[model samples]
Target: MPSLPSAASAADMNQVEYLGLCDRTAVEWETLRNYEMFSLSPDGSFPMMKASRSKAVRLADREVMMVGGGRCFRVSLSNHPTQNKLQS
Candidate 1:
């Protein structure tokens, strides 16, 4: 797929097939509270999953593989208004 605009935020990167640390931008990933691990859907209609500081990988679709805190987890994207965070 073609590259998104220069100001592509995490929400705009839902269709991205790959994700890395370099893909994060302050305007997109950094929250007012903290730069926590999170994921959102393309249409901005889904709830945001705010996990801990973890190594994460986004699948080709709307799913994320997160590994941190001595465990690994998988999350499926959906349209809900809730914050699913892992408790430390």
Candidate 2:
């Protein structure tokens, strides 16, 4: 296993592990601002985010690698996200 000495490095490593799961669920929504949210896993294995027409649905679901509904829990976002104020 890889070693992470610094606190930041340790946190980053954990995020990678959380992302390297089997599957995740999400939805599309509209937002004024744009940002990226990677999984909080140690392995950090996820598809790179890019510019797109639709917004991403921020979700905290279970990793496909494990089973059962109560196995996992919700984690915080990569960073603090600002709410998009849309004009009608």
Candidate 1 clashing pairs, residues 3+ apart or interchain: none
- How well is each residue in 1-88 modelled by candidate 1, as lDDT tens digits? 9977575577755553322231122233323122233335332323234433443434334355554333212233334333432231
Candidate 2 residue 48 Cα shift, in angstroms, is 2.2
Instruction: Please provide, for model 2 over 4-68, each residue's C-alpha lDDT reduced to its tens digit, 9 standing for 90 to 100.
Output: 76766655665432212322533222221233333323333333221233423334332223211
Number of clashing pairs per prediction, in order: 0, 16
Error of 1 at 38 (Å): 6.0
For each candidate, what TM-score against the reference? 0.21, 0.19
Best by lDDT: 1
Candidate RMSDs in Å, in order, are 16.2, 14.9
Whole-model Cα lDDT of every candidate shown, in order: 0.36, 0.31
